[model samples]
Each structure stands twice: as C-alpha cells, then as structure tokens.
Target chain A: MSQKTILNDSHRALGAKMVDFGGWDMPLSYGSQIEEHHAVRRDAGMFDVSHMTVVDLAGARTREFLRHLLANNVDKLKAPGKALYSCMLDETGGVIDDLIVYFLEEAFFRVVVNAATRDKDLAWIRSQAAAFDVAVTERPELAMIAVQGPNARARVATLLSPEVAAKALKIGKFVAFEGDGLFIARTGYTGEDGFEIIVPEGEAVALWQRLVDAGVAPAGLGARDTLRLEAGMNLYGQDMDESVTPWEAALAWTVSLDEGRAFIGREALEQQRAAGVPREMIGLVMDEKGVLRHGQKVLTEAGDGEILSGTFSPTLGKAIAFARVPAGAGSSLRVDIRGREVPVRIARIPFVRDGKPFDAA
Target chain B: MSEIPGDLKFMKSHEWARVEDNGTVTVGISEHAQGLLGDLVYVELPNVGDTAQAGQAAAVVESVKAASDVYSPVSGEIVAVNEALADKPETINEDAYGDGWIFVVKLTNREELEELLDPDAYAEAIENEED
Candidate 1:
C-alpha cells in the first residue's frame, strides 16, 4: 500500500497531480511544474514535506550522542534553537543521509531526515544511541510544511499564531523554535527565505489552508526538485549514497575533523583527507541546446563522470547539473546527450541564488 | 479534452493522422498524449522523405520526467517535418492536435486507415486505461 501524508487530502483538494514517490503518495504538481518552479523563485510557495521523517532525541546525553553519531560537529549549536546541517555516515565514510538537527536544549534535539531512508536512518540512530542511552523518538504524528520564496516568511507569519509568528520572524537562518505545539524552523531546501513548520498532524490541513489563503502558492515535489537542483542542494539518493562520500559529493564543508572528536567514519575520512579524494562534485551548464539529465555521461578533459542530478533550470533558461568528476578537472567539459557530444561549462554551484542567476563569466 | 475531429483518424498509441485534401496524411501526437506527458522539452521528428513503417518509432518526445517514443500509425514516406519543434518543443504541449502536428506523409497503402481507431473508440480506449 502507498503511504499517505497528513496533507494528502489537502493536496488533492487543490487539484494536484498525485504520484507514488518513494512509497508515499505525494503531489507532483498543482498544475504546471514549471509555473510552480517560477512561483517559488519569484513569489511565495509552499510544499507538504510531511512525508519526511522527524526524529526527536531527548536525554541528558543527547549532545554527546549526536557529536559521536553525526559527521558534522554539533558543538556549533551552542545557542538554543540553532540548527545544524550534517550527514550521518557509515563506518566506511559513505553518507547514510543528510539531515538538519535543531538543538532546543541540552536534553532535546530534533532531527529531520529523508523519507526513503527513514528505516535505515532510524536503525542506525537507534544502534548508535543504544550505547549513549539517548531516547530516539520518531515524530510521525507531526506534519511538515515548507513555505519558501522572498515573501515566504512574511506570508507564513501572517497565517501562524502571533506568538509563534513573532518568534519565527526573529529566528535566524538555520534556526528553529517551538511555540505552543508547533516547531517552526527558518530553514528550507529551496534557496529562498522560508520556514519549515512542523505541527500536529491533525492541525496540518487547517494550517495548509490558511497558508494558501495567505497567498502562498501550493507547490509540489516537481517544483521542489527543480528548485533544490538550481539551488545546488544535493538530493540524498542521487547526489550521495552508501557508495559516495561527503568529501566527493561537494559536502566536505559539513564534515568536522576536530582532533578530539571520534565520530563514526572519522578514521576513514581522515585517511582519505590525507591521501586526497579521488572524485569531486562539480556544477555543469550545458552551453549548447539539450537538457542535461541524470546518468548522462559527462566527458571531462581529466576523465569521465556521470551527472548526479540535471534539469532545465527554469530560472536559468537552460540546462544545468551536478556531476561527480575527477578532482582537478578544469572549467570546460562535454556531456553525451543521445549520442551527441554537447559542450558544457563548469561553473560555481547554485546556478541561481537570491531570486537571480549567478553572474557567469 | 478537445474533440478528435472526425476527419482525422487515430492510432491506439495516441497519435492522430489527418488525411489532407491532397491525399497526404499529416501525423501528430494527440492532445491526450501531450496532457499525459505533462510537458514536451525536446522532440526529434523524422526527416522529410524518410520512409516510416507502421508501428515503428518515427519520432522521439522527451519531457522533464522521461522520454517516450512516438510510433508511426501508417506506413508512409515523410513529405514534410515540423522544423518549428527544434526551437519550441513546448508547442506540442500547447497545441498537440493542431499547430503541433509532427510530420506530413504520403501514404503507401490507403487501406491501412481501416486499422486505426475512431474518435469515440479512442476516447473509450483511454477511459478504459484510467480504470
């Protein structure tokens, strides 16, 4: 049976095209995927991300448990309500999942992980927490909604309770706060200012309706994929998996190698860091006509690589992709599209940022 | 859903073949097909004068999600191809039954038209699919 989110009925009521995405019945789009993509870029839009799993770790040793479990150090989250992006890894230094952990207090930390990797992630977290005695509780009863764009926060603020709205407005980027029963976070997958609000499942439909009435466009997974891709955000399964490492996936910045912290996969990563990473993730733009797609062969001057995620950037008006190539590959490259070699230009990540395309040289 | 004009015959695979007054059959992907595909990002139409076999892959239609093969409904020689698709593939999504017609072909066997589905039958076929 396909899983249904708390907002499944709300999406259907909005005339969304529902599809089976990673076992969950999620909306692909309300109408036009391209229009939804543009809405998140130019105006405010909302997505029902309740399908993702939210796990709350609560115990006196919560901080200690996380410090040893996550690849990124949780020490940076000294301030309450601060959020940190980190990757959970296996013993071999491969990414299990990338997630956001919000530190509410010394005893409580809330982590949100990908839906498809929920089972494996939960098992890994539980197995690690067994030694630290941290209680890991999966919050499936909470529904998540991400409202994004330049006007996203303001629109969401208007729909939420005054107390919650006030606190959310003041929350810094990558921070989260709890007001009443709501967990409002100033974080999002789209490269836009927004809030990822987690509320009781029973209250989600009403909240979603309120946001829609507040002029937040109802976007779907289709737009979410395009927006995140253009933003240079990595999709867990596509960009990195058990066989791929954070260092090779252009996410080395997230990993902490502080001398004292002995986190899972730290040893392998340290060895790799000393030896040098064999592959590096790079952003590519198809200079010629043709949509760069995932699994398409990317032929670089140094060696060949495969596109991890590629799409026609509605904002850029052309095709762009994230490719895993040999380290030290130059700016110029080519990709095989339907047997034709299409010229590509290696550019800085985030083809678009802050509602505009990055200046290309 | 727009009415499939009676003058035009359709293939079960969701392609329409219009027999023009000059005895040529102009073929295009149906509106239903385009609606199902969502959006058309790229189209590869066969070259003019290329011989197309019935039920063969005559063209390629790609959307953001996946690529699909456009099959020939009738064996014919391509008389003309729609060059407009090269620059604006979205035209197929905008006007699948009219301006978005793929190619014009000179039919090899006019009797092959009998094998195609009528508008009502085609509609029924699609409805059955949803069930």
Candidate 2:
C-alpha cells in the first residue's frame, strides 16, 4: 500500500486519475494533462505539494548548523522571511537533495525537502545535527499548495483576509510571510508569479475548494512536471543523483564559495573545478514532430550522452529536453529516437516563461 | 465511458479491428488505450508495404509521459497507413475510433479474425481490468 496525502479524497472527488508516485498515491491529472499544463501557463493552477517534508530547526546554534549543512551559505540571508534554494551534498560533493530554506529568525528556520528523499534527508540532517546542539522537528501536520501563473497572486488574494492578502501579495519574490494561520511564500517551481501556501492539515481541503471556487484549476503531478521542466527546473532524481555533483547538474550558482566558510563537499567541488569538470548539462529542442524522451542517447561531436529529463512543451509547441554530455560538446547535437537520428538544436533553458517563449537555457 | 461499436472486433491489448467490404481490416487503438496514454505527441505508423504477424508490435505511439507499442491484431500486409498522425498525433486522442484509424491491413488469413474478441467480450475485458 502506498502512503496518501490528506487531499487524497479531495482529488478523487474531483475525478482525478491517481498513480503511485515515489511510494505515494498521488493524482496524475484531473482530466486532460495538456489542458492542465496550459492552465498553469495561461492562468492559475494549484498543486497539492503536501507530500514534501517540512523540518523546523530551533536552537542557539541553528543558524550555525545551516551554515555548515547546505552548499549555499545561509549567512547571506539577512532578512527575515527570506528564502534560499540550496543543494544538500554528501561529503563527496554528490547531491543528497535540493531544498528550500526559509529564515524566519535566528533560532528558527524552516526547510522544505523533496518527498521521495524524505527518509534519507531526515537521517542525514539528524546525523549532522548530533554535534550542533540544534533541535530538528518534522512538521507533518501542515499541507502545502502551490498556486502558480500570471494571475495566481491575485486569484489567491481574494481567498485570504485583507490583512493577510496585503502582506502576502506584497511579499517579495523568494520571500515568505506567516499570517492568518498560513505560511505564504512568494516562491514557486513554475516560472510564474505565485505563492506556495502552507496551511494546517485540517484546513487544506477547505483551502483547496476555495481556490477552485476562485477559478484556480487543480493541476496534478503531470502538469507540475511539464511546468517545472519548461521553467528549466531540475527534477531531483532524474536530473541529478548521488553520483552527480552540483557542478555537473547546472547548479553551480546555488553553491556559495565563501572565502573562509568550509561546507561539506567543498573539497570535492574545488578538486573538480581544478581538474576541469568532465560533464555539463544542456537544454535541447526538437521543433519537428518527434518527442524527445529521457534515456534517449544523444549524438555529440565530443562523445555520446544521455537525456536526463525530456517533455513536450505546450507553450512552445515543441519537444524539449535536458541532457548531460561531455563538457567539450558543441551546440550541434542529435537525439536517437527509436533508431532514427533526429537533428536537435541546443537552446538556452526556461523554454517557456510567463506564458511566452523564453529560449534562454 | 467510450463507445465500443458492436460491428468491430477488439484485442486484449486495446486495439479494435473493423472488417471492411473489401476483405481488408481497418485497425486503430481503442479509446481506452488512447485515454491511458494521455495526449499523444508523436505516432509512428507502420509502412504501407510492411507485413505484420498477429500480436507482433507493429507501430509506436508516444505521449508526453511515455512510449507505447501498438501491436498488430491480425497477420496481413499493410495496405494503408495514417500519414496525418505524423504531423498531428493528438488526432488519436480526439477521435480514436474514426479519423484516428492507424492502418488498413489486407488480410492474408481471414480465419484469424475469428480469434478476436467481439464488442461484448472486449467491454467485459475492460471491466475486468478495472476490477
């Protein structure tokens, strides 16, 4: 049997097609996956992200703990409610998981991690915190909903109290605010203006219905994948894993190489940089009819490569993919589709942004 | 609930066959198959002159989620292929029974048609899958 979210009954009531995702019973789509993809690009769409694990760290050394825990420096986050995207790395520089850290105060910080990696992430954090004297608490009582699109903020505004709405709507990008019994963050995986609202578990269903009443379509994991892919975001296991380092995952920007701050995996990263990283990730586009898919072999002048994540872009009406290849590979590339060598162009990522074509990979 | 015409025959793999007046069989995947595959992004039809054996994988249908093999329902020579689907694969999702017909086969052995499931049996098979 698979674990289920609190919104399981709600998804079934709305006629969703459910699938087992990473050992969790989750909605694949309510009806049409394509329409759901368009809904997030053209208007507002909400996703049940409650499967993600939420951890709270509180202690005098909590800030110091995060500074040593993440690849990205936490000292850069000076303002309260500010959020940072970072990758937790193993000692060897392999990514354990990528997560979001919210700095609410010096002694209190909130971290949201991937659902599939919850068990290992918790164990890793606990093991690391043993010597830091910080308290690590998991909050399974909260449910998360991400409402994303151009009109997402406005649509969600009408559902909140005026005071909360004002504060939430005014929250800067990459920021979060706790109000009206909810933790509203102006951050989203989709390349749109929206909020990832975390509500009490009991109030989740009501909040979902209210969002639906406000014309926010209930999108499922299918749309969520395409939306994030189009936004040039990497899926954890697909794009990178325990064998992939941040340098090869196109996440070097997320790593903060402070002068004196020694974080885990810094030595490996430094060695990789000095030795010239062997692999690099690139964005691919096939404008023709063929669909680029994961595991498809890529033909590059430097050598052979493989696609990490691939999908059909609804906004661009083209097939897009992310591939890991030799660092010396040129822009010219071809994807092998069922024994057919199809020509593909290397495009800058974020294939579609703000419901428009933004080909900056 | 998709319409499963009484005049057509089906395979357990979710492909339907219609025996035409010219002793040829028009083949297409059932609506249930299309629905499970989601919105198709590409379709690879069998060549017009290709020969196929019953239950053999003959064509390919690709949706955004994954790729699926469309098996031949009966042994025959491919007489016609749906060239339109190469440019617009969503037609299979829109009209799986009508314009979405994948190919027409000139049956080399008519006796094989007798082995296919009728509409009643096909419907029951689908129900059994749900159970």
Candidate 3:
C-alpha cells in the first residue's frame, strides 16, 4: 500500500492515471501527458506536489544549526521569507539530499525535502539537531501545489486576498510569504514565473478546485518531470544520490566555500577540489529522433559515461538528457541505444527558458 | 475500452494482428496499448527484409514516460515497415489500428496464427488484465 495525498480522490474524480511514486499514490497524468506538458510551457498548470516533506526547526540556535547543516551558507538569507537551495551532505562529501531552506523568522526556519528521502533526512536532521538544542518538527498537516508557466502568478493572484496578493506576487524569486492560510513562494522547479503554495491539508482540496476554476490546468508528475528536465533542473534520486558529490552532480555553485564555517563534508570537498574533481555532469541532446534513457552508455573521447536523467522534451520536440562523465570528456559524445551508436551534442542546459528554446547542453 | 475489431487477432502483450488478403499479417499495437503509451516520440521499426520470430521483440516504441518493445505476433519475413513513424511517432497514439500499423509479416508458420487470441478473447484478456 502507498500513502495518498489530500487530493487523491479529487485526482481520480478528474480522471487521473495514478502511479506509485516514492511510496505515494501520485497522479501521473489526467489525460494526455504531452498536452499537460504544454499547459505548463504555454499557459498555467498546477501540480499536486504534496508528497514533499515539510519540516520546521525552531530554537535560538536554529540559524546556527542550518549554517552548519547545509553546504550553502545560510548567512545569505538576511531578510525574512528568504529561501536558499542547498544540498545536505554526508560526512564524506556525498549528497544526502537537496532541499530548500526558508528563513521565516529569526528562530523559526522551514525546510522542504524530497519525499523518497524523508525518513533518512528526518533521522539525520534530528541526530544533528540534538546537540544544538533545536526542536525539529515534521509538519504533516500541509500540502504543496506548484502553479507554473508565464501566466501562473497572475492567475493564482486572483484567488488570494487583496492585501496578501499584492506582496505575494511582488516577492522576488526564492522568497516566500505567509498569508491567507497559505505559504506562497516565488520559486518553482519549472523555468517559469510561478508560485509554490503550501496550503493547510484540510483546505487543499478546495484550493485545488479554486485553482481549476481559475483556469489553472491540473497537471501531474509526468508533466512535472518533462518541464523540470527542459528547465535543466535535477531530479534528486536520478541526478544525484548518496554516493555522489555535489561537485560531480552539477551543483558546485550551490557550495559556498569562502566562509570559515566548518560544515559537514567541508574537508572532503576541499580535498576533492584541490585534487581536481574526478567526474562531471553534462547535458546531452539528440538531433535525431529517439529517447535517451537512464543507464544508457555514453561514448566520449575521454572515456565512457552514463546518462542520469533523460526525457523527451515536449517544448523542443527532441530528446534531452543529463550524463555523468569524466571531467575531461570533450564536445564529441555518442550514446548507445540498443546496438546503434547514435551521436549527440552537448548543449549548455537550460534548453528552454521563458517557454522558448535556447541551444544548450 | 478500445475497439476490438472482430476481423483481427491479439496477443497478451497488447499487439494486434490482422490477416490481410495478400497472405501477410499486418501488425500494430492495440488502441488500449497506445492509450497507455501516451504521446509517442520515437519508434524503431524492424527492417523490411528482416526475419521476425513469433513472441520476439521486433520493434521499439518510446513515449515520454518509457520505451516498450513491440513483439511480432507470428514468425515470418518482414514484408514492409512503417518508416513514417521515425519522423512522427505520435501516429501510434493517433491511429494504432490503421496508419500506425508497425510492420507487415509474411507468415512462415500458419499454425502460430491459430495460437493468437481472437477479438472476443482479446477483449476478455484486456478486461482481466485491467481487473
């Protein structure tokens, strides 16, 4: 048996095809997944991302705890409602999970982590928080809805209170505001202007219906995957796991090494940086027709590599993927699809931004 | 439920076979199969002169979600392939029974056709599988 979200019945009522994702009975799509993918790129689309775990940490040393907890420095979050994307690292510099940390108050901070890593993440956070005297609490009574696309923010604005609506829409990226019994954040996995609203579990159904009434097309996990892949966003388990490091996972920028903070995995990262990272992640695109799938062998001048997360981009009408390879791998690359050696080009990712194509990895 | 043409036969793997007047079998995935594999982006068809073995994967169909193999319904030499699907794979989702026919195979074993499920039996199989 799998866990279900507050909107499970609502999804079935709307004719969704359900699949087990991360032990949650999540909707894969309502109808045509390609059309759902287009809904996010061309107009507004809503995703029931309630499977994501919400955790609250409150204490006098909460801020101190996070600074030592995450690879990205929490000192950058000066103002309230500011959020930062960071990777939680293990003792040996391997990535445990990637999450968002929001500073809502001086002593109260919120973190959202992947559903599949919830148990281990909670255990790790708790074990680390014990020494800092921080109270770590999991908030299971909340649900998340990601409304994405060009018209997303404006479309969602019509449903909020006049006072909260103004500020929520005006908030900068990576910023969140709590209002009207909802937490609205100007951040999304899709490369679109949108809001990831965290609503009360009890009101989630009504909010979903309201968003539908506002013409926000109800998309599902299928569209979410394609949109994020096109946007050059990394999926947690596929792109990077506990055995992988941030430097090799195309997440070096998220690491802040300038500070004197002796965060976990700091020494291992420093040594790896000095020794030259062994592997690197790159984006690949196939000019010909064929889907590049995970675990596909990639041929490069330097050595062989493997695809991490690969998907067909509805926006580009082409196949795109992320491959992990030797750091010295050159521009020339080929992927083995069955028995055929198909050539692929390395594009600078963010293949699509602002709902348009840009030549990229 | 998808249309189960009484004139065609089906395999448990969701492929359908229609015996043509030319003594060849036209093979394609069922409408139910196409519906499950939404928005196909690519299809790898068997060669025109290739030999297809019954129950063996002869072609590949890929949607955004994943890739699936289209098994040959009966052993035969491939007579023709749907070359159009390489450029436009969505044809399978659009017309899995007509223009989406994957390949045509000249029967090498007429006895194998008898092993395939008829329209009524195929429909019942789908219902049981769905259940």
Clashing pairs in 2: A348-A360, A348-A361, A349-A360, A349-A361
Off by over 4 Å in 3: none
C-alpha displacement of A93 in model 2, angstroms?
0.2
lDDT rank order: 3, 2, 1
DockQ of 1: 0.52
The DockQ of each candidate is 0.52, 0.83, 0.91
The C-alpha local distance difference test score for the whole of candidate 1 amounts to: 0.89
Query: Model 3, B1-131: lDDT tens per residue?
Result: 76677899999999999999989999999999988887799998989999999999999999999999999999999999998888888888988899999999999989999999998999899889889
How many angstroms is residue B87 displaced in model 3 relative to the true structure, after the best TM-score fit?
A: 2.3
Full-model lDDT, candidate 3: 0.93
Instruction: Give the CAPRI rating of model 2.
Output: high
Residue A23 lDDT in model 3? 100
lDDT of 1 by residue, A7-78 (tens): 988889888989998899999988888888889999899999999999999999999999999999999999
lDDT, candidate 3, A77-164, per-residue tens: 9999999999999988999999999999989999999999999999999999999999999999999999999899999999989998
CAPRI tier of model 3? high
> How high is the CA lDDT of each candidate model?
0.89, 0.91, 0.93
lDDT of 1 by residue, B1-108 (tens): 687788778888999999899989889988899877776777888998899988888988877666778888889899999999888989999988888999888999
